[model samples]
Target: MLSKKERAEEDALVEEELQAMGPKGLLGMFSTKGAKKKPKLFLELSKAQQRVQGKNSLVLRQLDGDTMSDKLSTYKKTIRFHILAAHDEAITMVKELRGLRQDVNARDEKGRSALHFACRMGSEAAIATLIKEEGSVDEPDLEMRWTPLHYAVMGKHKYAAKLLLKYAPSPYVTVNRRDKIGTTPLMIAAAEGHASIVRFLLDSSADINDRDTYLISQGMTALHYAALTDQVKSVEVLLEYKAKVEIRTKASGETALELAERLGSHLVSVALFECK
Candidate 1:
């Protein structure tokens, strides 16, 4: 009974709604005729919700509390890591995710939450999206104190660390955040070879001199860790940031340069030894 123009307008609106779902659009909702039928994940989603809310109430809520139910759906879907980070496409996804579930939050198996993934992937856009979409920006995962910025530093994603610092710098700067191994982001970056992250943190006014009391004093400063790992560039970067040259690890009783020598890293030793 509708006119052609009205019908066309309605079609366009439906198309827009479909697009609005973003990465989760059309998720297990359709059955292609004659195609091999895949198990419907939404069925599992419904079951999960039913478990949370009794079946009768859930059905009632779906009918009378449609908006709330939609939010719950969005939250559940966001928790799943099925969607790739898709950093390049996060802005639009941000709008959609926020609009769908303003309170969306979730954690992965290793206790690395969405924010952690955002940092590890060096997606500033995704970080912004998570902040604007989810209210739990500063929420630490199972590690209790390790924030997304911490992961960024450990992952050696400088831009991600920078963005995290810019948007949601943890209030507990000097407070040591430990992982399962009681290693701080600074320690992880130092032990491995993430020089850029060390420089970024130090330049951002991070407590370069702070030592982790929880861990054995493996020669605490970013310089000692970098030197131990034979990270030449990292050594130079940390030294430029004024990391102490003479600092020694508690257990090993070795200076950063000594660790570099013992590891057979001549270049790393040269870089650290040459530091004033």
Candidate 2:
């Protein structure tokens, strides 16, 4: 993921590109006339993964894995439109499609916006489009209340996540928003053992002690998830950020120490017991 500095650099580059377009050219970029110039597309397959491509260029790097079943590639692959060159390509696509009544903010059955698609697929160009649209980035999917940033982190695409964090209207809100299951992105990272994301979320000022609603206890925090899951590095990172392991679940009255102990996570149980 880009730091604030890196994202600023990306913004500067986009500004430079936009400036070079002048006025008429910028207008033409979004016109029907530009549609003919849309890039040729292909599904580039690598091992079990697939990313959409425009001729020789990598346009959208969101991959779908194969599991020996019939490989059903998404026909909407054309939506990419070689926009990977700059997210402005998406802006151009939007303008070209505007004559046909497109709701850029429209949600799918799962309540995921196009921005969610962009993040889940690792499409920097598509992400740029959604950011340019500005209304879709923070939209949460219905099932889990997962935002575009959530999809990005779940995809393990830090660059995409960083882009959302840096450019979204409320980066802090997106970073801290909890899903329906009462888990923060931090909890997801800790439980999934995505140590890097845990660190990134912490540095982004995510609440170290934030807890979920109780499915078992009155909700366990990221520390509890990490301890129970035996994510050693994640537990260490949370502790440094002032995570309170002494906090206990309301129902079972079990601290993370007790949970780790019951789960037979020797390393985490020992750390929490000693710290207490």
Candidate 3:
């Protein structure tokens, strides 16, 4: 073992390296930024209609809408500031809007607010400014009952999620809150193979065995989804966090281990067997 001074020096080096990597750190490498990006998912719609939603199009003020006149709604234009991370513009407009005592959380046709757009953009500075302006942290869009935290995690915006967890009013209120589909942020992170997010949510005391209702009758836990989707690291982390291994699916009555076996996910199956 090194002396205390040497250990402190080593610790400082690690912290410096992380900060040098910017807001994303190690998780940045695994983010869905390029070809690895998957389809957009949120307050999920029917399977067929789900494809229509974009990863960032939470608002319904479409560019191609029939009423594409210059007189677009104020909220729609303001949301653009958040999406574009126009800090100076956002600050000026938001201050002006506040002076008029307007609703910062005003919803577009799809119930999305500027705050929602900020979260989707993963602009931590923009999100912090909006939250400081009294933006509602737990507001839901028409797409689903997803909170800003949900969007942050789903977008692989770890910095945004960190800010929300620290500053949002009662992180517990929305930390585990389920969407219309009963999917929690933890469940979404697992299915998408977001191992770092899985670790963060687990550390934040997210329910390790929380259940969700999918499109059909399947009542699945985070582990079930991880196993079914071949998220090997997610399976290991869930089991390590003491997630229930005995929980069975509501429809097929399959446990996570069984699901992994069925999908020929040998690595996940091996991890589950060790859990058993």
Candidate 4:
């Protein structure tokens, strides 16, 4: 074992190496004018370190007077910020830190998991890494009961969605697996007119007629959601899957065709009417 002075010197060297490999340095590798550009992730990483170190540890060491939990909360925030900002290197570093017992599962004030942030930023690689690390894909944020899949759809990130589906399938992929409006993955895809996703989900054996008790009545199906949104293609896809055309909502007591007509989606109305 090294003497106290030698150990201190070794620790100083390790800290210097870490700082050199940090976000600011990583940015320099991308942009020649990085110093002029001011990478926000560098600042976030600094905040994260302060958070991981905890104020209480500093106080206990007689170095400062801050609390441990407070510092940890701040670190969690920084981890989220880096994930949201699409800082791939930063995310890698954070995961490594978390693997070293830095608390990777920490949630932000919004209750969004890091996987949600990767989806929001359309970072497929980061998302893939998180999923491989067995990160929670089912966590909901503050709003929309939105999971990573919800963010992927809203952000229009096909690749990120694809990555998620590859690593973790829906229903099994999302927690409570329900949207804020109480819709499922198939329901959200239908409502948003995402025909491809609709088709994929249907092919994946997602229940074509799953209905949420909170938003609509028990009888409503994916076709009902599709027709309501005037998504003609979605309606056709559901119909092709043998979805019940005559399904009705408890609140509206209207068939898919009737709802389609009300929404002025003539194609969907016509298709539903033609359905057996």
Candidate 5:
């Protein structure tokens, strides 16, 4: 056993060594201060790691979003290109798009389908293809409520009109189908001076004297439209088909001849007068 003085001297030397070793020394292993500080440092490092991981995850998500948006944009542009190609009678390109799983019945903003464009462009071959592909023959547009047949007649496409009539699920329904203003295909044919189409419609069981029952042109027949538009040949055809010459419009109460005279349609007026 050492003397009290010797014990004091040894304790002093141990304190000096501990002070020099600092917090990371062997003495720190049993020190509560060092224990607390180590846990705090570890927590800070973990928080930094989590922040880096969060930033990386956010960047990955943003990249994915951008990639998806680009894909969607590309898809829309491709679809539009194929639709325009259909209008230009690019049947092969359309078929290719269809083969790639694109919707064949996709419509434009105005609800005009591929078949409608095909008819408006007078593409007989494209019309045939669309019909074979199960395109709706009597599909009506959202704007004018005009069917493919109506477009065919409006564009003076006789063959396209014939194809529509031939492929229509119901011939009678399609031939006499009316528009937004209650104007039937025959009425449009007459108004546009499409005499041959008028004759075709009449032969196809279109009501020759079917009247427009919609707004301004209410109670106006095919003959009335022909006469008002100065379509002499159409008027003659209507008369030959036994169109009512005396059928008066509900709005104006004018016969076909009277409407012709009022509209200054000299040729149509003569034809209606001769028929009367």
Candidate 6:
């Protein structure tokens, strides 16, 4: 029979072999005659299990984060689709999504918000809903930097414009906000021949003689746009609102009357001349 020291040395060797084989070898020890020899192998197995559990937990958390991100993206797309549809059911869907805490002010690829599309489409109900939900009114698109008020005026949606003006956090900022080319809502209204919108903008204290920063339209006011576009009624409205007809283009130094005459806008030219 081996001495006590010899048996102890043999136990140490077996333990070293089990550790080198890892948790799998520990399981094999259970089926062997050496199973009962070492009780410390159970501790090694427990440590291996703990490591696997930790890795699994990290993977689960990452999946949850991805799921939340996907839901938010889908919600944004659905809201935009509803705004484009501009019907009662679509508006209802938007409201439902908003009630679920979805972002009402989420922008599309063009950086346009729901309020911007609502105003552009002249959806009065959608506009009211988004406004009541506290969506931004003065948010500008990435491309044109146009606010909701700009779209309303451009579309000649009088009531839509009224709603935006009424609910705007800052009436002056919304009314006088400029686009990428430095054209204000008033300038768009005048150029589009939207006489009513032009008048409303003027009454709302829009800058009547605001000039654009574009090369061709530089230093041109709402009056110049109306005159050049042959917008007779818009010209009349601007004149009634006391738009400065004396304002001249930067490059051409031509006043609204001169541009009107050169463009052959007979009615607008006559209006500008009379105003002068």
Best by lDDT: 6
Mark the regions of model 2 whose C-alpha exceeds 4 Å error after superposition.
1-101
Number of colliding residue pairs in model 1: 1
lDDT for each residue of candidate 6 in 96-165, tens digit (9 for 90 to 100): 6567745666664345666776776688887888788777888897767988898788667999999988
**20-109 in candidate 1: lDDT tens per residue?**
545335333222456575543332345456335533343324332245444334333443321333243475556556576322355432
Cα-based lDDT for every prediction: 0.58, 0.64, 0.69, 0.63, 0.70, 0.71
Off by over 4 Å in 3: 1-71, 85-96, 99-102
On TM-score, who's better, 2 or 3? 3
**Alpha-carbon runs more than 4 Å astray in model 1:** 1-76, 81-88, 100-102, 143-145, 169-182, 213-219
For each candidate, what TM-score against the reference?
0.62, 0.64, 0.70, 0.66, 0.69, 0.71
Model 5 TM = 0.69
For candidate 2, list the clashing residue pairs, or say none: 62-121, 214-219
lDDT of 2: 0.64
Choose 2 or 5, whichever is better by TM-score. Answer: 5
Per-residue lDDT of model 3, residues 1-276, tens digit only: 245585456445544544554665421323356656554222123423432443244453443334322112233343334333422246654665668634567565456666676676677666877778788888876758778878888788877888887886787766788887989989989998988989998888788898997776788999998998999998888888999999999999999999989989999999999878
List pairs with backbone clashes in candidate 5.
Answer: none
Q: How accurate is candidate 5 locally (lDDT)?
A: 0.70
What number of clashing residue pairs does each candidate have, in the order they appear?
1, 2, 1, 4, 0, 0
Task: Put down candidate 4 lDDT per residue, 1-276, tens digits, no spaces.
Answer: 235585455445534543555544422332346366664433234645644544334321332125543434344344434444355544654556566643344454345566776676687767776777677777676646778887776666767777777667554444226776667778878878888877777666677777776644455677888887888888888888888776688888888888878878888878877775
Where is the poorest 10-residue window by lDDT in model 6? 57-66
By TM-score, highest first, what's the ranking?
Answer: 6, 3, 5, 4, 2, 1
Where does model 4 exceed 4 Å of error?
Answer: 1-81, 84-91, 94-102, 169-176, 215-219
In model 4, the clashing pairs are 55-66, 56-67, 138-175, 144-180
2 or 4, which is superior by TM-score?
A: 4
